[model samples]
Target: MGEFLIDLKVNKNYIWVYFIAFYTLWCIRELWLNLYLDSIDSVPGAVTSAIIKIIIWVIPVILLVIIMEKRNPFSYLGLLYNVKNGLKWIGWASLVLLFYSILNITLLKNSIDFQLELREWLNVVLLVGITEEIVFRGFLLRKLMDSFRFWIANAITALLFVSIHFPIWFYKGQFEFPYIFSSILTVFVLGIIFGFIYKKSKSLWSVIIIHSLYNLLVSLFY
Candidate 1:
């Protein structure tokens, strides 16, 4: 049965089914965490949430890689950037960070307290950035491109990416009209940017670096 499913061609319909199953399971896990997990502001809650998120996002992606690519999941996700490419990605990421910092400093300068500890940095990079990039840009974008035009696939991915965050943000009391709408729009734009980077570099590392830095900056400034 498993072999039969694995043998199915990766067409649009199959990708749609895969995407649906992926998010259904993901949404359920997120909902359960929000319902039972403590507020993320607390250190323990934040740690627990990070751990659970890694488990939730990573395991399915691993399975997908094994089934579809039949190879090392990290390489399948384009995680093998050499030093030269890594520096190149860092250069691009620097520009992103510069613009992000400027935007926040100029317009949305909130006096949010930033807990710039080692653990927070680790969580942002590993849990939030790497895991999400692998799921959305690395896996979802790759599959969608195989089945659709580039712009169309990216548009769909961006929409779903924005949609996925809504549940958790709403649960966490960030559903205020102006805030939620603006946040979603910002995320959608970022999703497009991330997709573009993945398409250009053929790797997830650049986008992951950008995302982790962006998240850290947002935590610091807004």
Candidate 2:
């Protein structure tokens, strides 16, 4: 019982530490990008963002796990792809996103663009998924699950996910009234779904693919 209490306390500390470090870096990144994005063109902007995400999201955790814990960070961060039903869950996940894309294209009559910019491909299609899944599902949600049930951990993680987007929404001038509410709700639901997919597939790459694909489709048709 004493050891269990100690473990719980440690888990809570980890969550708080990660939350503080990540949010601090995330806010700095947002501010830096806001300044840089207006002055620079798309390619360099995307490059800068990608580099920052690595620094902010991926590298610190890797270093910490190696230096402090002396454990291979790969599996802890859900970098493995050898799980059973990986492809099956990926297909199931993609189906939901594909349906959204199709509905937007056909029923909503949204215009579609097949040709994509290099920045869009790099930033949204690739890095966004990889970095975000690594941070949210791989690290945060998994850590939370150490203390809480899967759904409870996921809900907390999803709430944090929604909170992080507030900076962007406010910066974009959409953080007002019903739009902000609806947008938050949508993101929260998506976070929950992605968490579910991650849990079911036991593969970070599965969520990464679907997340990237969803963004790509939205970029084209939405």
Candidate 3:
């Protein structure tokens, strides 16, 4: 099981350290938010939340590529470049995913409410979409592929991607059956899909845009 992970840490051993640290810190961020910062609304709260995520979710992965992998962060993470390919992949992905959304609403008889706040746009949509991809697909999935096959690595990475959301679900009291189970499964599937996109396009931005779009659709619909 363990041998299925990326071997970058086997000799230097810092990869798992960063992974563990980031996971623990993300859990703590949720705990602190629900425990204390829940009431900190408005711009201040959004700024604080974004800052927290930047520290915990964004920084560690950047450091991992820069320090551990000893490579350029942008190149390592497949960001800001490969624009054409990213667009091409996202174009195809959007068709399939948007079809699902259309089918969902058609069956459910729901319309797009099309509402989003500034904080959600900044913190939830952009920040989460960008950073989470950086951590999971750009960093983890690519690294994991060194040791394990794509599907195997992607499955494990997807489970991990699901795990990171548990604390927030737990804190928000959304960790019950049916909802939790379904949500976890959905997220795991998303992780797999995102990995596939990244693998095909070799562009993190492709996954990022699709991920942000998924979140945006969910927000607009429900």
For each candidate in turn, the TM-score is: 0.81, 0.89, 0.89
Q: Model 3: residues >4 Å from true position, as ranges?
A: 1-12, 37-40
Candidates 1 and 3 compared: the better one by lDDT is 3
What is the Cα root-mean-square deviation between model 2 and the actual structure? 2.3
Model 1 clash pairs are none
**Per-candidate local distance difference test:** 0.77, 0.81, 0.84
- lDDT for predicted candidate 1 compared with the true structure: 0.77
lDDT tens digits, residue span 108-174, model 3: 8777765677667777778888889989998888888877899999998899999998997898789
lDDT per residue for candidate 1 within 10-99, as digits (tens), equals: 433565676687678778866876777556546777687677777767788788779767878888778885535656876978886888
Better of 2 and 3 by lDDT: 3
Q: Please give the lDDT score for candidate 3.
A: 0.84
Ranking by TM-score: 2, 3, 1
Query: In candidate 1, which residue ranges exceed 4 Å CA deviation?
Result: 1-14, 36-44, 81-83, 106-112, 116-125
Indicate the worst ten consecutive residues by lDDT in candidate 3: 4-13
Rank order (by lDDT, best first): 3, 2, 1
Alpha carbon lDDT at 25, candidate 3 = 86
Give, for candidate 2, the lowest lDDT window spanning 10 residues.
Answer: 33-42
